[model samples]
Target: MLHKLELIDIKTHKITKIEFKKGLNVLHGDNGTGKSSVLEMIGFVLFDFLPENQADYVRETHSDKPEYGKVRVWITDIKGEPYIIERTVGKPGVIVKDALTKSRIPEIRGVNQLKAWIGRNILPMHEIELGKLFDSSIGIPQGTFINPFLRREGDRKAYFDPIMQLGVYEKVFKNLNELNKKFEPDVQGVSETIHEIIGEIKIKEELLQEQESLNAEIISLAKKLTKSESKSKGLKEKYKEIKKIKEQIDEAQKKLDELNIKSEKENENLIDMDSQLRDANTAKQICDETKEAYNKHIKLSSNLEILEQEFEKLNAYKEDLRINNENYIKESTHLKQLEEVLKKAETNKKKLPKLERIYQEHSELVNKIKEIEATIVEINAKEEQQVKLEEKASNISKNIKSLKETLVELPELVKKYNIMKDIELRIKEHEIDVANLTNQLEFFKNNQEKINQHKCPFVDQTCKNLGEGTFNEDIFNNKIKTKEISLQDIEKQIEKEKEEIHEKEIFREKMDILEKDKTTIENYKAQYRDYQDEIKALKEEVRIKPQVIKDKKE
Candidate 1:
């Protein structure tokens, strides 16, 4: 029970102190006269209860000046000892003490601490328990009493679950139901797995039967494989002999190709030497012809020197004339340029007055245009400002339209949010269901034999009537091995074909090279013969040169 409540400068109301008796105490006052406020303060000091309009209780209202205040309550313990608990508004600490003994109780530094201390040491019950008791009994707000009854069953359960301590029991019941739900899938999965295992067992038995037949077939195939291996051995021996012969042929061919190449080069060198010999004979004939021309040139040399002196004097006179002509042309061009300049100056002088008049007019027009442009600029500035203002107005209108649209859709959006929350909750529930079912399924899959033996409570029937599938395991393995052998054989054949093709291509390339070398050698031999014939002709022609030139040459 609250013994007393003291408010100092709290909301600045007129009533500052209130005393309560041992029995029921009632606070009756007009509205806005601190009747409800006093009750709220009592609840706050005792249990840290805050009102919806808590700012009103803390705000200064009486004067313009700001002030700090406190809400202090005297609470009586179960032994009837009075304790003062005070909480300063807008402050960080709480003070609790023995009122009669005037000894300070241990201070609590926070609202939670103070509430905890009061609930433990001063109050007859825990704070939450007392609050529930008070709310259900004497402290019922208007309309709250009937609200629970009006709510849905789930909502009502939520409200009362904590008060009745039924949450744990409900959670346990839900978990059990979930476990049971999980067991159902487990039972079904176990049935299926048991059937599968039975089928596998039957298949293994069938495979054992098939293995006997496959063994006979394997013996036949092994005999055939031995014959093929023996044949392959004979082929390998023959192939090795063929390979040795081919290698010998390649070596002989290589030596023949080298000899052909050397012969072609020698032929080329012979042709080149023969060509050089022809060139030398031609040079000798040329030298003989040049000797005759040299004699003529010596006879005319003195006359040519005198003519060259005269030609030099004439060339000097011609160069002087060319210089005079260039000077004359330059002067004439300068005179023409001066005349054109003078003519242009005269024309400009004649147009000066008119130009000055035009300049004055242009200046006046420019000044007028500047004034007009300034006016236009001012107008454009105003227009730009108007455009900006219009844009702002348009933006404001758009904002208003958007706000109206939002207002129109707010209820629907809120409904969607609530629906989404409900869906999320349902999804979570379903996920848990899925997890339980999956776990049960996995358990069943792992423990199929147990389920088939009726060891699981959820499984009522065994998988005795289920059909077991059969598989020929040994036959399947033998087929796989056969396919692998076939694949290897095919790969070996492909590699052999590739090697043969490569050898054939090399042989063809070598034949082509040998043919080209032969053609080159033939061409070089023919060229050598032609050069030798030309050298003989040249030598004969030189030997038949005029006796006079020949004596000079000797």
Candidate 2:
């Protein structure tokens, strides 16, 4: 039952309110007195559509186009609760409010949702049933009752098809009901139990992982145990060999001790030989002096015999000569024994050639010692040269390594340069796209009315659907928003590419520097090789130096 009806800016009724009684309601009017228009408004408010042309909902005005129009119906549902259903022109929303609280029902958002909600909750029928009842039963058009059999077959089928599909829905609902019943008859703790089972499964998986790890550990330990056994067995053999080696070492130590004692005795004998050589040199010098003096004494003795003959001729000293004649005889005997000693000294002097030979050999050994010292000095010089060459080689190696590292990066840097170029080109293209889209969006916004007069009014460019002269407001607005969004998107892409190009540009600079450094690699390599050759020659010289000194010593 409709409790009230309200109309604003509708056909022939700018503002009208009508109240209906609880049992019955009637509209008393003549023809063309706006009765049918009120019925259309009721149908439009209740069913979200006018039973007649849709445009009839807009107010019929003698002025320009109307801006707003609405129809509201206050009705009592089957439970005797009053509610309001409202619909407005140019808006797709249908409002249903609790008449008691006057609060809008947010659940009934659009016309379709409200229809579905009314069918499901308010009436035990579909939305199409309400439309059929309103069209054919409640507000049957003026003379439609005369058409008993002239209804089109398609119209009858369209009406009957939804009814026929109820059987399928019945079967579907039957199956769904069974499925619902087959669910747990008692689901009091099912979710908790499921959670507990899942936790147990997770714990079981964890324990399995732990068991696997422990098994792997056991296998690894077993392998280590086998290795340890092998090592222990080898260690026992090594211990035996070490014991034998200890015995051999003890024997070698005894030999070394004996050799050390022998060396000490030989050193003592060398000291004795050195002393004997010195003594022999001193005796040769004394022998040479004694032989020369004995010759002088012989000469003097001949002279003295002549002088004594002269003394026999002089009788004045004859008495003094008789007093010391015994002493003079003793002196002559001493001189004869000294001449015999001189003869033995001359025999000793005959070995002076052998002493000279020994001295010449000693001089040769000193020369050999000097040569050995020179060889050592040469070895020191060679080692110093070797060290300098090694330093040079090390420096060359460092340079080579630096060059290698730089060369390695050159390819990647070049690749980055190429990538940066590609990104720069892409960024330019994207920026161009952004500019084009911005122009299109601006042209559409600025020339909206002119475009609508000509074509779809949605885009700046000419479209295929020309000359249709139809306008869809939603499509027009959405197309504008989409173009602007695309412009923004392309601009954002250009910004991102600019950032990428910046990073690649930095890499390109690095590539340039490294590429220039690539020429030095061969130079460093050549220097390294030359240094290595020089080091090899110096090492050879150092190696033979000790042997040269040894040959000199020998």
Q: Show how many residue pairs clash in every candidate, following the order shown.
A: 0, 0
lDDT of 1 by residue, 1-554 (tens): 67778887666453498888878777777767777667667666775565454555665654563445688788778777888887876555688888889777643556655654565567645313444545554456657778777865444654564456555568889999999898999989999999999999999999998998899999999999999999999999999999999999999999999999999999999999999999999998997879988788887997899999999999999999999999999999999999999999999999999999999998987776666566555555655555555555455455545445435544454455434434433343343343334334433343454443534323444444332323222333454455455555544554554443444334434545544555555555555555555545544444433542433333
Candidate 2 per-residue lDDT, tens place, 1-554, comes to 77788988877778999988877677888877789888877767765446556556667776785766888888877778889998886556578889989999764667656665566556655323556556665666777864634755434444444435565688899999888778756564787788899999999999999999999999999999999999999999999999999999999999999999999999999999999999999998987879888889999999999999898878658777886897899999999999999999899899989999999999998988887888889889889888988888888888878778768877777667766766765664575465456546655565565455554443446544555535453454677899988887887887887777777647856876776666677777888888888888888778887688668757
Give every collision pair in model 2: none
Task: Give Cα distance to truth, residue 338, candidate 2, Å.
Answer: 99
The TM-score of predicted model 2 comes to 0.29
lDDT of 2: 0.75
- Indicate which candidate wins on lDDT: 2
